[model samples]
Target chain A: MGNFLLVTIQVDLYDRLALNLEADLVQMVNKTGAKGVLIDISAVSIVDSFMGRIIGNIASMSKILDAETVVVGMQPAVAITLIELGLPLKGVQTALNVERGMDLLKTMIDESPIEDEQEYPEDDPFAQ
Target chain B: MILSLSKDNIEVVREQDVVLLRNRVKEVAVKIKMGLLNQTKLITAASELVRNMLRYGNGGTCLIEVVSRGRDNGVRLTFSDQGPGIADIGQAMRDGFSTGKSLGLGLPGSKRLVNEFDIKSKVGEGTTVMILKWANG
Candidate 1:
């Protein structure tokens, strides 16, 4: 079993910065053969479509590294906004809290493919 | 008009200032719908417009107004920049269309998020973007 990587981001939930975060997380997962990754966003009160896209992108990239990505502690308000915007979280798994995400990831690592079925679409409008 | 912030004809100068403006817009949007996920789209669009004013216009003021339009309450933000205007307004609106590396989704994405979008630009003059969105009521 590979080691787990936990990265916590405590920044304002904006677009450009979120893109930077996604890139960083993707790079970390690739660099370290971590079995799973847990993202903590309890500090963020708001999230937008651009940020959602970034999270979705990270989740998609994690699968390539054979690592599972899970988002933990998303605020209710932020979740609601994401639903309204139609921003699909795509390959990422989510837990009510970090502990739960860790448990879920552990289970997946032992059983089915830890990598999620959802893949990033090639024709994404926001593709850089 | 549920929320409106009018500056006494002053220009906003600074990158952080743009974030603040975006926060205010988000605040209003959140109030409209306690569970609105469009905050990301709204904030992204607002950031793009504000960035345009600060980068191209050098530093121009903006008036942000949120109104309840149609079935949903939407944000109506106007950014007026007094900088060198665009030569081709149509070309500027296209995606992957950026004056710099910062993802040119400013004009197009902002237009997409809102229900109504209007832009007026003139060469050697200035540019004004008016964006409107109706809440999902």
Candidate 2:
């Protein structure tokens, strides 16, 4: 939690950039040995399926490396777009903003073995 | 309508073209004062469809315009490609369906993002997808 990484994406990312980000993020997770990764995407308004999958992959990769990932500051539109894209963003934890994400990360780190997965209804958009 | 704008067209052949197309959609959405959520959804849908045009089809043309009917105003985007075309449109629209080994969320997922979606294709001719997002939705 104290060593979490904060990444902000400010531009519209093409496919290649998205792939590069995925690779770089995983590497950073391993190198820093951070307990959590917080990505601030408040500036990004649009999200395609490709971007959605890349985010999901990044979370999975980080989790395997013994790190928690909290994506913060997601615009309502982007979340809504991803939901409609049929990507549940599984295994990814989200927070309203950077502060809340940091708090969640700290709590997870303090609690150890963050195992609870808040379930959603069958029709819920974020349900995975 | 104060949002009347001329037709804007772009050619989608390479990966860069996809980004450009999405930007154009965003511009039109902004002109119509479409909400941030609507703009995001429209741009995302445009990105997916443009990539589909480049991936499955032999590159295509995207037409962007601000459309108004009576009192309703919205942004409309139509993508047309003269690629090999889809032999089975129904099968292609199913979720998690892909022939190129991708995630297969291009078509059906994009359709769900916009307010209006229409697709037409011929086996050997081409395919065209049209989408619209209303301002007040």
Candidate 3:
């Protein structure tokens, strides 16, 4: 079993470049065996469709890593834009702030039983 | 009164023209109090249309007009380009449909952002795309 890891991304309000962030988040989730990730976009005043897609992609990939993804600090306007654009964020959790997200993650970790004995057979094609 | 702004045949078909078009759209959007989010949507849709005209049509003119339909008040933008017109307007409207390496979100995605959309094209003549978005009263 992999050890728990935590990663945080602080999004800027006007930063337009997002492909790099998306790739990095996916890579980190795959490499760190993280239990969860917190994406803080409190500073972002706008969430364009391109940026929305990247965040959605990150959430989808993190699910494959068995890591939960939490979005923090989404401005009200950004949430409306996401809804208007029809970006699917069904499985992702959201919080009003990073502190709240951390508290929620901690609770989820404590209440959930650790799966230390889950093992894959050798030569399994899907084994990482 | 509705005002008209057009680019010279050569000047109209450029990526920078998108910026000019967006500015005009913003001006009209503000006059009607469309809110920031609605303005952004109009800008995004306009940018995509302008880019398509510049890249595919080699150059084209855009028209911006204000309109009021019953209780709805909004801006209408029409982009007309005289280049090798699209042979398949239906296919072009599909997501992931592109002649190049773009994400292919131009037509369909822009359509989603606007309240109303219309497109007319001729294979050899040219194409015109119209989009409308109303202010949220």
Please give the DockQ score of every candidate, comma-separated: 0.16, 0.66, 0.15
Chain A vs. true chain A, TM-score per model, equals 0.79, 0.83, 0.69
Residue pairs in steric clash, candidate 2?
A: none
Give the Cα-based TM-score of candidate 1 against the true structure.
0.62
**Once superposed on the true structure, which residue ranges of model 3 sit more than 4 Å away at CA?**
A1-16, A28-34, A108-128, B1-28, B44-73, B79-85, B91-109, B124-127
Candidate 1 lDDT, B6-108, residue by residue in tens: 3223357876676678767777777667235456556656666777778788877777666753445666777888889888888888865778655456677
Q: Which wins on lDDT, candidate 1 or candidate 2?
A: 2
Full ranking by DockQ: 2, 1, 3
Q: Candidate 2's error at B17, in angstroms?
A: 2.1
Tens-place lDDT per residue, model 1, A1-128, is 34778867786754457777878777877777687888888777555544666777787788778887889998785665555444546667899998898898888777664333334444566877
Q: Given candidate 2, what's the lDDT at residue B129? A: 94
- DockQ, computed on Cα atoms, for candidate 3: 0.15
Poorest stretch of ten by lDDT in candidate 2 chain A: A113-122
Model 2 reproduces what portion of true contacts?
0.93
Superposed Cα deviation of residue A83, candidate 1 (Å): 7.3
True contacts kept of 3: 0.11
Candidate No. with top lDDT: 2
Residue pairs in collision within model 3 = B13-B59
Worst 10 residues of 1 chain B by lDDT: B1-10
Q: DockQ for candidate 1, please give it.
A: 0.16
